[model samples]
Target: MERTILMADGQSFYASIEKAAHPECRGKPVAVGDPTRRSGIILAACPVAKERGVTTAERVGEALAKCPDLVVIRPRMQTYISVSLLITEIFESFTDQVEPYSIDEQFLDVTGSLALFGSAERIARLIQTRVQLSTGVCARVGIGPNKILAKMATDNFAKREPGGISELSRANIEEKLWPLPVHRMFMVAGRMTAHFARMGLHTIGDIARLELGEFKRRMRARMGRQSDIQAEYYWQTANGIDPSPVVSGMRSQIKIINHGRALKWQTYRTFADIEPLMLELLIEVCRRARRYGYMGRVVAVAAAETDGQRSSGFGRQMTLPRPTYLEHELSSVVRSLFLTHWKGLPLTHLHITLTDLSRDECYQLDLFEDRSRLIRREKTVDAIKERFGATAVIRASSLAPTAQAFERAVQIGGHFA
Candidate 1:
């Protein structure tokens, strides 16, 4: 059977959610970000702000200079996640084969649902209307025979039009997809684009017209051993011949969980000022690791200095004598790593990563530590936090004025609310 996949992406997601929560901001120039921080960047901008030349990741001051009347609001990441969950639920009503691409984008395999819901275009329109009416956020829907084409149709066509729906099929590949620049095609990196340009291949049609062997030869010389695979994939994509399936419940395969925070201001000038914050991050990371019933053998710590260019940072990784999910064990190693590597540089960001993962039950007992007791205590703490709230139990160090744990516990994705 011919597949029918749809990609649905929320338009100006963060700004839209802010507007939805505050109806007064509608039709006004608005952006979502931390306006209080000097280095704050625009996370998302409404259509009005976009029309005034305000763009995402642009500095707040610059964005204000572009549109003096712009309304700046802090991001409420929890609210956006709630709305995304609602949108995902709506997609699930249409098809079980729904794969979330991000916080504001998802892919749905509606080939099976077509028999009950009508044609692909009809389902696309229904989903768009449903999302708008239910969430007060508009969604652009793109329909295609496969995931790549659906995403491309969304990015290149649907997002630019009033109807907010577009379709790409094998029959219209030449007329609709070929005229676009090669750089616009999915998975075409800057180096690949430059290589293609050097070969006088500027459009999707140019690449599609090359013989498989000749294309593979050129790609090998340009990209190395994986060139044959990359060349074939790109050639097929150019011809609208994707065969990948839309997958759901894929998060089970995650091997690492990390948490990083870029400080609101460059306030840490010494390790004394930085230690508490790093401890808080370690606690959160360990809490998550225990919650997921996974233990990691490797701990990686990274720090980025305060320079606006972020040219200086240190990253170091160490393997534990035994895998652990306890914060105490991980924090000891982290503290050692930071103190040894730090050069008294004013830091803007800190991150902790846990990797070399295995199931929690796979760990071997340490010869010196009371491993079982520590594991039990950690699990008990996790249970309390899960049942009550993140701040129900806090480390005494977190109570220090410089620490951010109390503030972070109530926020989502390191943003307000």
Candidate 2:
């Protein structure tokens, strides 16, 4: 039996959520972002805002200039997360096989539920209606035989359709999807589109018409060795021949654990000024490794200058004497890396990564140090935080004026909660 897959996405997710919450903003232009911050850009904009020349990722001031009466709402990350989860529940009610492609988009495999429901189109409509009625946020759905086509159908067709539902299949793909510009296809952004055009492939049909071997040969010539896999991926996507399954409760294996943050406008020039934040990041990274039941033999630290130049940053890694998920061990190496590499340039970004991991089962003891006692203390701290909140039992250094842990606790993605 052919699988029935749907890619459902919330229309203008953040902006729509803000509009739904504030009844007065209905039918007016709305954008979600904070204008005062250095990174203040329109995160999401409603259809009304888009029609008025407002675009996502544009400066808030630019959006305001476009739509004079634009209602700018600060993003409530936690609230958006709650609504996303609610939409997931609504989707789960219709089918057990649902995979979240992103916070605003999800894929549903309803092949098994066709008898319980009526048709793929009907199920798409039902899911759309359910999400809208429950959350007051409009949903657009694209139905297909597989995930790639479903997502493409959503991005290209469903979003433009009045009914906000469209279907694409291998049989009708050439008629409906092929004539569209190559950039209109998923993963074919501006640069790729230009490259495709240079190769005399201006439309989806152009790529699809190429023999697989010829396409791979051309891609390899331009992209160099080992480009065959990526070349084939694009070819498959163009032909709507995805074979990947919609996995429920999907989790990717953790090969490395890392955490990093970009400073909005604050640039630390002194080692003393940067130490607290770096320590906090190292502690957090170690906590994550411990929680994942993994220990690493390598630790990496990165510092990027505030100038935004690609060459301004330094990233260095060091192999540990042994694998351990303890904060002290990681912090010792990270601090050394920062002190050695940071050239007194004003730093706007900091990062810590743990890699070369193995199962965190046991550790070799040292003759000088009581390893078991330190391990027990770390485990206890993890236990307390798990029982309470992440910020419940923070290090005393977090209380320092320079520390970002307390501030970061309430924010998501560097924006206010």
Cα error of candidate 1 at position 34, Å: 0.7
Instruction: Please give the CA lDDT of all the candidate structures.
Output: 0.87, 0.87
Output the number of the lDDT-best candidate.
1
Clash count (model 2, backbone only): 0
TM-score for candidate 1:
0.61
Tens digit of per-residue lDDT, candidate 1, span 1-417: 789999999999999888888898878999998988747999999998999999999999999988998999998888888899899889988998899999999999998999998899899889989999998889999889999999999988899989999998888878998999999898887988999998789998898888888888888877787778888998988877877889974434559979988985467877778888999889888988888878999999998876555457899999998788788889999999988887667888899999988767557877788788888998898899889878888888888777987776766536744
Clashing pairs in 1: none
Model 1 steric clash total: 0
Give lDDT: candidate 1, residue 51: 95
Candidate 1, residue 195: lDDT:
92
In candidate 1, stretches whose alpha carbon ends up further than 4 angstroms from where it belongs are 251-417
lDDT of 1 at 299: 98
